[model samples]
Target: MTRVAVVGCGSIGTRHIGNLLSLGVSDIIALDPDSGRRDCIHQQFGVKTCEDEEMVWNYRPDVVLITTPPKLHLELAISAARHGCHFFVEKPLSDRVEGQDELVEICQSRSLITMVGCNMRFHFGPSNVKRLVSEGVIGRPISASLDAGQYMPDWHPDQDYRKRYSAQSRLGGGVILDGIHELDYARWLFGEVAEIFCHGGKLSRLEIDVEDSANILMIFKTGISAMVHIDYIQRFYSRSCKVIGEEGTISWDIHGALKFFTAKTGKWEVVEPPAKYTINDMYVEEMRHFLSCVEQDEATISGVEDASKVTRMALAARKSMLNREKVLL
Candidate 1:
């Protein structure tokens, strides 16, 4: 069995551990500074728990899942790569503006496998969008828009939402970074983002320092324009995207399924293959792919380079928000 270490015991970290266990990975270790969190995991899974990050390195795990926080992701990932271990870091790459370039360089120099938590790409709904774009099913996507949002307090009723990483900017918690799922999907559907114009702030239902609403406009190299609306004040979680082309448009809803429209048909039709998924499904697939990469000695499914592009988009949006001017990225 491939040895793995989870460097955090927060909500997502626990989810990753559970998914890894479900995959029959017994050689697992958990490291969390919070004694209570570590104790709970030790009692739940009987996995070794340590209060030190160095113990994780000393454990000599073949893979490390850095789910600590965005600010610590680069440092942890670099350390893991230096130890000749593969790494899996969660979404939005890093919170800080610096270190991303160096992190990619280190991973490249060591030939280390790295996976980012852009799980939307692996989901059936968005995977079909990628397939359709590749096959020219939409006659070259020209434009697209996405809407993703949810109420913050509703997210964790049992725990204080303010204490989570998604609550503070220093922790890489905000509408843009935390709400970046749709941004990655749009990139997967179209091309690399050329420039971004955005306006966002903490002007919504939640009483937090971080933003609860964001509106972003992206320009792609292929002359494609896209808009994204993200908020953390919705009572119901909604994740949906619509792609428009010269011929027709295809829309996919994570809550529902796929809906198609054609000019000639003049009617909206639901066209989809068998698809069923959940948040945990992405976690399972992410861990499974990380396992396969380690076993086969192959490259990671999603590397630092891919995740950096998405980070650049988020960073540009943040810049736009602060400077009160459009930022090119």
Candidate 2:
């Protein structure tokens, strides 16, 4: 057993708990300030529940997961690292770029295993694209584009979307940060970005102060040009990416199939991959990677240092949107 404690019961946090349990990790503990959320988890998952972050840490858990609001991530992570516990943190680090250096320094000194919650990397569709791009199947990828969006209210029909974390800027809950999936995958496929130009605003709904829509253009250091579009208002849930290369192009629906297109064929060609591959269990896989490192004192598949790059990109995008100009990375 990993003897893990989950430090939030929100949508992503609960999903992590459920996914961990599904992975045969049953010795789980949950911590949440929301009493009803914690009680519900205790009754349903048959796990111990703590009232706050401190008690959960005081128990000396083998592993700690920080799934709380972005503002509190660094504080709780530093606290857990001080107690000699490995951690898994959800994306964006913090709403502001403050305290990250201290957190990163402490984790490095403690040699703790840390993984960011960027599930798109675990998706077979994108993973296949990455492989193809690396294997010269598409030659050298020169440009990429991603279109990802969904209606916020439809995210969880049972809850009020207005009160959710994604609707709050103070929580680092805008589409740019919340929809960081595309940005992470881009960096994973095309390397670091050199600059970013973004346009965003609260145009669609009156329910939230945060930007519900965003259009971001990225210039990669490799001279690769990429464009990303994100929004909270959409007719249907959609995630798609297109990578253009020297000899060909790689494209996919992210939910359906991945295709490779060559100039000779003048159309998209199917790249066969295992149908059994799935991303639904990515959270569990990420958890297992973290716990195994915790047990063996090894490095995790994704480290905090790598995660820092994505956070920097998100923060730079925010600055670009604020300044109404492109910001160099």
Candidate 3:
């Protein structure tokens, strides 16, 4: 049995706990400062709960899942890695690039397996898009357009949107960082982003301190230009991307089918996800993948290196937005 300790028992953390239990993981421990959340986890999942993060060393967990805010990810992950524990950290890596290089170095030097919580890479739509692009079905991707938006209030109907981490800049919340799935999966399909130009602000009257919207332009190392739009004002959730290639085009949207157009066929083709596919399915698959990677001593879907690069790109976008200029990475 693998001893796993999960830090932060928030909404996402609880979801991971549920999936870990369903996967038959025994000897699970949860660490969160919030007693209410700890109580909920104990009652809902019957997992051991602790308020102290240092308890991980005593528990001797083989893996630690960091689901805390971006501000705390680096500190917790570094501590866990120092104890020779594998890690699965949530995305955006951290609010800034501070200590990221050293953290990556520590993980690599210790031969630790790490997986970032960018579940979008496991989504059926993006998975299929990667396959099609790799197969040359769309030829070489030349450009892309990606968009993701949802009303912040709708995100957590039970809580005040203004107080959530997504609405606070200090907590590493913003459309750019919170909705970073677009940037991440874009890189997964295209290549590394070399330059970025962005413009956005509290365009909407959202009662939050952070920017409510942003439009970013990225030039990948492959010279593929991509545009990304994210916001917190959409009444209905929306997430989709379109990739344009020399010979065809491929696009996908959440809860929708993949659409492709080829110059060879001159017709549109659609690829629908399996009828049973759901958003929760991605997290389950991600946990299974991470556990397997840990057991096999293999790299993860989004390892430390990829997480650091993605964080760099995100920070650059923030800088571009503030300076109102193009940032070259």
- Candidate No. with top lDDT: 3
For every model shown, what is its TM-score relative to the native structure? 0.95, 0.94, 0.98
Report the C-alpha lDDT of model 2 over 100-204, residue by residue, as the tens digit.
777788889887788777777877777788888888877787888999999999888999988888998777688888888899988898888999999997889
TM-score of 3: 0.98
Q: Is candidate 1 or candidate 3 better by lDDT?
A: 3
Query: Model 2 lDDT vs. the true structure?
Result: 0.83
Question: Which digits, one per residue and each the tens of the lDDT, describe model 1 over residues 166-190?
Answer: 8887787888998888888788778
Q: What lDDT does the true structure give each of the candidates?
A: 0.84, 0.83, 0.90
Q: Which stretch of 10 consecutive residues in model 3 shows the poorest summed lDDT?
A: 51-60
Better of 1 and 2 by lDDT: 1
Off by over 4 Å in 2: 263-267, 272-279
**lDDT, candidate 1, at 325:** 88
